[model samples]
Target: MTASSYPVLPDERLAAGVARLAVRHQGRYSVETVQRLIADSYEQLAANAHVRTHLVVLAERFAAERLDALAHIESPTGGERPRVLFVCSHNAGRSQMAAALLAHRAGDDVIVSSAGTHPSGAVDPHVVQALTEAGVALDEVYPKPLTDEIVQAADIVITMGCGDACPVVPGHRYLDWPVPDPDGAPIAVVRSIRDALDARITALLDTLPGA
Candidate 1:
């Protein structure tokens, strides 16, 4: 019934991460809240992960994003930048590329996040290679499942081939970009998809409030 209701096996490994997050969000949330989110994030990511080497670090990063989203949703600040969420089926290719491309071009002008309806274990290699070729840093990027907090914090929800699985939040601008999936595609095709997403992001940025 609640986020805390999700089963989280106790792991001492997450203690350091929880402490860091608590201090980072000092006034905004309690230590228990950070611990709960970190545990939940670890569980969600570990569920379908193929490699567990960096799972703990990734979990910490994921939890931090969720906390930031939750903070934004709870507090209403004037002149806040528009938030955009990109969603695809696996979050391995299309959504990841779109989010990275948008963030690269948008800079600090917009808040960008991406997730999958059904997240894969890792990001597509081709997706990483293509973004790398385009000079966008893909460090710390990983496939993440959709969550209510992130969706609720978005000003625009862009769906790329995720179809009806993407959540529909009232008052948020929803756009469906029918882009081709680059799951198993070669580097060339992936690069083309990246360029296409870049073009789309360009157009979307122009329509944003401060643009």
Candidate 2:
């Protein structure tokens, strides 16, 4: 079917089921394009609570039916490693902390990235300071959008404060840790967040195969 005639799914389920339809029709579109279309259509069905409630199923289908084939599109020619994405409301606090701490502790065992639901362009100064104090040296960290490639590449997606804005892709492990925001907070509080994130990172490392 042409893009103009692309049927909008009724809700998440229908949106999710599009791949099955495509499979049945042996559609001309590539799986990547079809998955992108499905995601866009589902996001438009923003009215129903069932769509939100059924997100896990939708994500699962999206991953299995669509994402799995395209999951490592960003990796190197020889294939790299499993990635982890950390997301927060601003990408300036919790996500940055978690990502930095994980990278520091895990020592490149996993590829780690962080993003925002609504990015603020720069990492928070306090977050940088806290991480520096904790010896993480976050000189390269910057706020970025939560993209499809990032989500697909990540084996685990951790959301600290993005709430409902974080994308749910199927077949990936997702966690929402209700950590407090450290923007404009005092150094002590920032340090506390740093410590907390380090703890979480340690736990995450333990779950990894070679940790």
Candidate 3:
């Protein structure tokens, strides 16, 4: 709940994330405030990791995005909320989780799409189980490959381990979540990854400029 309660991180890692946030948001937020904000953000996503790699990076990103939203930042989309595309190696796992989570949480506030660089035959059974457990139905959704049209239209492109195969449109807001491939991971691991996505997605929706 407070910065002092932030999940423990290595001193250098914590300070780096804090300083990055403070400097990037220098004009709008003070260094002291950004430090607290980054710590709080780290706390928000800390519980979900089965292993705590890259928590600081994700936290800094989530914190900075929220701070931008608090300032009512505008984007290339102008008055409209963003349309986000989630891409991964296959549409079966991480991308599917992200798409479902964002849709469930954001509703009509944000448009959501997802695709894979190399399409699989169907959505992974475990991914479906995870979504069903969360009460978000997208059973009809299947593995689909990325398309230029969707990529061009998206206001934000979020790649979850898609690597070089992900499309790059010059004007879009591109972000790589660096989420691991969830293909063979256990249900518990999948859920933990889902929680991370929830943190990032919520922060993203919060940052969307309204129509």
**Count of backbone clashes for each model?**
0, 2, 0
Candidate 1 global lDDT: 0.90
lDDT of 2 at 208: 78
**Residues 27-131 of candidate 2: C-alpha lDDT, one tens digit per residue:** 444645565556553453232222255543443343343333243553334545567889998777898889888888877677777777776646778888888
For candidate 3, lDDT tens digit of each residue in 1-211?
Answer: 5656654454347788777777777777777777766766666555333335666676676565556545543333356667788999878899989999988888788867887887665677788887888798773655555655567768789998877898898888998897767788898888888888888987887777661
* TM-score of candidate 1 relative to the true fold: 0.93
Tens digits of per-residue lDDT, candidate 1, 1-211, equal 5646533535778888888998999988877788889989999999989998899999999999999999989996989999999999999999999999988988888999999999999999989989998899877789999999999999899999987788998888999999999989888999899999999988998899885
lDDT of each: 0.90, 0.67, 0.73
Which pairs of residues collide in candidate 2? 59-170, 60-170
1 versus 3: better lDDT goes to: 1
Task: Assess candidate 2 and give its lDDT.
Answer: 0.67
For model 1, the superposed segments whose C-alpha errors exceed 4 Å read 1-10
Candidate 3 Cα outliers beyond 4 Å, as residue runs: 1-78
* Per-model TM against the reference: 0.93, 0.63, 0.61
Ranking by lDDT: 1, 3, 2
lDDT of 3 at 63: 67
